[model samples]
Target: MGRGGGRGGGGGRLAFVVAMVVMTEMTWGLGDVHTSVATVAQLVEAEHAVIFALKDYVRKEESRLETIKRYIWGWQDGRADYVHNPINSYHFLRRLTHDFDSVRRALHHEDLTQALRANITSLRGGVEAAAEADVNGAAYSLVRLQDTYNLTVDELVEGDIRGTKAVQELSADDCFRLGQQSFNNLEFDLSDKWYQKGLELMEAKQPITHEEQLRIKRIKQQQEHRILMRQLVTNMAKQSDGQMLDRFSGLGIPISFQRQIYAQHKDVAQVEQLDDYYRRLCRGEQLQPPEAFVGLKCSYVFGKGGYRWLMPLKVELRWDDPLILVYHDVLSEAETELVKRISTPRLATTMVHSFTTHQARRSLARVGKTAWVRRGDDRTTDRILQRVEDMTGLATDTSEDFHVLNYGIGGHYDAHVDFFDLDEKSLDKSPHQGDRLATVLFYLNDVEAGGSTVFPMLGVEVPARRGSALFWFNMKRSGKGDYRTLHAACPVLLGEKWIANLWIHEWGQELRWPCTRDPED
Candidate 1:
């Protein structure tokens, strides 16, 4: 997958892309999605969640250490490196990174509720534990959002994301922690910016240590070195190949430069540009439209199907090239609730198809849970399929089961197409359902903040509106993938996001959505 938030096509050659994508996923197992906050609602409850999560871990560790002390006394009768083992070292690092930092903030918080403050005593005995990976993932999520959306650290501290504000703003301590984590992650620019913000905020309230001051200075020095190296590389790139080698002969410049260029090449410099547009679209910025789609308008249209006369679909032309349309009130409140109720019990952590391994695996690129709600699962789903057929004038028989998804904290699906263009072998393994011809995504709930579905190529953002459905063609009339439809789900930054996707296949749509030699269609 591309770090810009999209599933990269399968092929072992895209391994470099995997490295950048996997960095956001998790170092260990699939991370705890609940621990990360993508929206303002999650941010308001963050401190409370962090407190309860860390309490039990601290209590248990204390007990375990007491037991170890007794054992050490009985065995060695002296102190040694009792906590030197891998497990102890691991937990110790977790203490510094997760537990201690969280607890410190909780202790110093001025806005903690009376009930939560009272529970602080019980935390002295026992509480809950959050995973280490979850902690790191949560910290990095803010950094990811900042980078993707081009949000300022000040905006983040104020909890003002694109004019959507949270009840609580991040504190100076929070800024410091973000900076510390960014430094650990080697994001020097972000680390320096966050550190500067923290220092500015902390100056009047608390004294920063001399060591901390020195650390910031060291970070500045590192930044200078990095910029210098980049300039040198750029200058070297302009030199003739033979001259470049001769100028820096014994310095191993050729080998090092080749490695650097190769790394940059495989990471998809163009994909990075695609991501820039993707982020801008998600931020609801307007991009220059293709000349053909200059003045598209919203209108009501009834298809040529038998059900067309019953009611006209409220269609908003999102993108003319790929024929993206948004249908209003396609689902009812009752049907939406019923679908969610059926899916709730069946929901499990969703997985992305690994391009290299050709298997589904958990990834932060997609953070949420999904349930396969088949057509016959209930009358509601069956009715939904009928409605889909009515709206698109396509056969329902070849469509896949409804994929009901509920996003958790920081939930999102990176940019990807619904069609499995790279999985041709597996496509044959199953009954010939054919490639995904079109998709109808039914929004089950209204999002308070983020969670807009964005198309990077076309600069389109369709916000989630309950009962509304967004429809788009994934394959052209020629049965080839239409890359213009490449889209992604922006991370939910506030209230819950619930959606159901119905992917209509090409097999039975041939008669309805007939093929054409004109690929552009």
Candidate 2:
């Protein structure tokens, strides 16, 4: 079980060398595989893929190596950390050490194929033994094995040595340089290939240590996390409000908000009648906001600001009629419960930061968090738009547009105004017209402190509450602009919070809503 005895067979050593030379000749003869056809472009691509795979593998292997080494060293040094007496435990280590040695030998001889084959055999046995808990199974031997296998395959197929002299044959620096170039070009796939080849070379010379493996794993995890975030954002951009809300609900946060449905001038008469209409609208009855008047409100802040302050209220006048609604909460009890379930300390902070950074948006609208297209089929999002149309007594074909943003602690939208000013040429390529007219934001939960939607120039601080919404117009009725809509998410302090936003764009202006443009335009 120890490295005390060496294999005393010359036959084995001779066989290994012969196998290496034959394989090298075979690969080289595969039509300038190592030179003529080894264009920088093809080699670079292959090298990158190999590098990423090997980097991942090396990381895992290093972790297992650490565990095994620690145990062995501890036992040898008479440290209390080592546990003996279990024959199975010793057997596991024996196999693991053997595999390690095999890998070392293959690498030293520059024979990746043989090394990999031996490593895989050792790993399979090691994994099975570890799974059965017959040995010290705390080590993640399987992960290492899989990564190594993948890396070896990639390197074998893509690596090459070039130059007039053997001395200039593919150096480790050359492979790594190519890999770095691919990474710089955002060619992740290619970059990974080269890294793998470099790893193969390193492996042949010396195996990576445990600490190195840990560092590499963290790097890969970070990269993967970023990729996932980007994809999620892209998906969010394509969804309707209802769909977005439903997706948010699935993540365990619910939203509730109040919508203002203006009455038609002809439908208005006595003050009592107007009161009744308003009551009906609040009860979810069909009533539309007036076409002549615009509806506006303020939504919750994404992050917790440093200071607690009441939001400054403002009213915009159109023909002597005010069109904005201020102060409201956006979360339902069910939603609150869901938020409580999934709002972790780290997640809360991340959400809050994302919102404050303008990674999230807020708005007001009418709609259930979950819009169902068919029984058991959940897919509609324009419930707020439908409500607006119904209440206003307008007849435009309405569609749902919605979004759910998670604002954990420290969530803030840096400072941005939402308006799009794409030229005619750009408009032709856009999906939605530059028509974001108004925005509605609903605060799903309240933080213990901090969290406010701040308007710096106006010196206003709109606080967050359950079921409260803040609405505002980003675009004027004349299709012009309004500068007052510029806002930011203050930082969060304690407790977790949630919010849902709806950006109401003029028909065909959805594309513009998501883009940045001059508010004045």
Candidate 3:
């Protein structure tokens, strides 16, 4: 999830099944979570705006990340070490070790915010001076610093489309796309309406092409498939009286995602095997290690920098897109239990917002409850935040309250971006706390199956592990959202999944790491 500010803004389960049925019908990643649907769909259909606005925004942000990488590469002491390593790979992690002491020093003083600001100021001066002296070297050294500095801003843009009065909205193709998405989500009635509308638009313009005819035929077939799926789900829900989802754990297929995946990847047979294996794992059946985990020995544990923060000594699991780090046992068992106990009473099913009105509502896209673990004056609570501060090196005061999430069987979150989008500075709709810069997530408990944090874009799956933390950036330095960060929380197939989230914000980091306009190397 992206960061949220105090901009405190802020759903149910048969009602939930129905919603999941709708989500199941949409194209997997396009509509994504409900929050961005209206905004993104609007972008796609809003005429000429589609070509330059959405696509260019994405391209520029991606290019910016690449340029920063090159700049930092010049700063590196040894470029040879990274010859075979992609910027997003684990080998690039070597560059991050150098920043540990510098970032930690900011934490040494009592006023963390000021200390960090001072350190960043000093460091920026040094870098700029070096840039003047050696030009390329300033850009080449310590890439982790560049990456961390940029990603530190959380959800900078909310992509709020509210009150967009003068712009053209939802075009014909947009309706068709939404239709396809709804079809994937299993909202047949809604999907059909959208498709029919698109068909009408096409007929109005000219005669339908043979391919268009085929599209209509395929959609009808998909509608039939949805009918079958609805029957199965309704029957299962009836049989168990909605009390036992565990039984369906063995069904091992992307029931809601089938049509959507079929449309995009067009490989139903391959999906079946994948679905079966995933389900088997969810059902708690043991299997041989996959290629990714082969020869993996993540047994060794070590510490680094001043905090000597605990992290897995192995580099078995890593990814770049938005740079993810999965560190095991970062939190002790007692620490985990302590936070859980404090948060149990506060748990409530998670909710999404109406982008325009900012009203809280529930939907199937996210099927869990969340509560905050505030930075209280209590020693344990304060220490928990302190540990988080040490882990991330950002001032806690500038960040949002710690969020504790709980997931039971069937709980899941769909693909979504964590950053908010801001444009023209006229849209004052960003969250009060500021955009999320980076996300620090600690897995408080292990699941018997499922509950893996899956990054679809980066092809990374990190299963929940007790006391382990998964850290990643939500935004790039320019504060633009990183599309590559799109991720989902897979349905909890077995035991409960517990996690803690700390959203470090751009507002807080501004004082520490100021932004620069020229992102080019």
Candidate 4:
């Protein structure tokens, strides 16, 4: 299972594609059958929907292709350095690259159904690999992908925004805040739109302050720079096909490189440079850092945690937040499949009790479902848990039951701490162990779009990777919930996100990691 094979032809994806096609055909046919004509706003709405839906997939396709191209060109390090499937990563990447090309072609077609079908077809290899590697999780993500694709198709065919509330309802501050958020997400067009809209909203409302005027001026200059930079990217991709050029335009490259050379035209030296550039971009390094660090004690350097367990593969240190280690193929395809299999049957919609409502409610902020895999309940999971304990140097019984979460579109947790507040009541009062001291998140599958575990205060965002683990301490050196750990699960814009969380308690591990009584440790 460790060695990758050709993409297996599975009935799972084909069946799903057929079902979605039929479902969407019926849903969208209603508009065409009727005499009602769609307004311009409807068309714009449909386009925006597609843009939001495909943003993540576009990000993934480019990132994976760049990574694979580097490896093929002998620039990338060993395979175990990143969290990826051993059985089908290369083949899946190859398939994704081709699929991306197909999508670009489909976008040119007049009939969007053709494009939607093409989009579903592109996922064939990925679906196969995902199903082969993680059965329950693969099915979960496939359904989510299909649903979003179908929705986009339906919107394109029959959807309308004519009757919806106008943008006039938004205040200047609302528009301003939204613009900032879009800018942070790298949606440049949307950011500019909101910024402009805020300026418009300012007219009927309060007078524009000096700061607001300066901000609007700066944003105008920045937007102009972005346009110039985009044009620079266009001139560089001289040899690329229209489809490939479209991708490069979206990649958000720096404008400083003035010369024109398509990606294919790069020499060995240029290839290395571009490889480094793409890697940094994919890791969110291009994202602007906040003005000040929130609650962070200090910056960290990457290194091993000095654990006793010996990993046969070359252990990689991908991050420095509390010794983040990524051991590839640590969980085999079979192991991942078994874990998902056990957890899926008991999956339940997670609920949070809001103090404002005083009632348990499902939140729009998060839509991920969860299930627990108790320790020693199954053979594969037992071994996995033992491995986890050894890896963390935590006592065998100190960790909580394995928590599997599935986050779909519009699913996110707003910026919040993971550790429970003693004084404040929790939303979901799940039966769990002591205060969470540390955590190890096993990224079950690579998300297609927007499922970054973002720590806004710390200015850190870790993309989820299959067969990889991200470990971090929830508490500071003084044994309190680190506000620096204030984080959120960004909304899944494109594909579903599957992850398993391992929470270690403060009940044990005195010998391994002793607590500090001092408040300012």
Please tell me which predicted candidate would have the highest TM-score against the true structure.
1
Which of the predicted structures, 1 or 3, would earn the higher TM-score when compared with the native?
1
TM-score of each: 0.62, 0.31, 0.44, 0.43
Model 2 residue 491 distance off true place after TM-score fit, in angstroms: 1.8
Over the full model, what C-alpha lDDT does candidate 3 score relative to the true structure? Answer: 0.54
Model 4 stretches with alpha carbons more than 4 Å out: 1-285, 288-327, 353-360, 423-433
* Positional deviation of residue 450's Cα in model 3 after best superposition, in angstroms: 0.5
Off by over 4 Å in 3: 1-317, 354-358, 424-432, 511-514, 518-521
Candidate 2 RMSD to the correct structure: 24.2
How many clashing residue pairs are found in candidate 4?
A: 3
lDDT of 3 by residue, 181-216 (tens): 545444555556666666666566657789877876
lDDT of 1 by residue, 268-377 (tens): 55666676777777777777646746678888788666566677788888777778999998888998899999999999878877544557767656877899898788
Worst 10 residues of 3 by lDDT: 151-160
How close to the true structure is residue 18 of candidate 3, measured as C-alpha lDDT? 36
User: Could you tell me the TM-score of candidate 4?
Assistant: 0.43
Residue lDDT tens for model 2, 22-106: 5656786765555555455665664565555456445645654565465445343332212221112233354455444544553
After superposition, which runs of candidate 1 have C-alpha atoms over 4 Å from their true positions? 1-132, 162-168, 180-188, 199-204, 207-269, 289-295, 304-308, 422-432, 516-521
Clashes of 3: 45
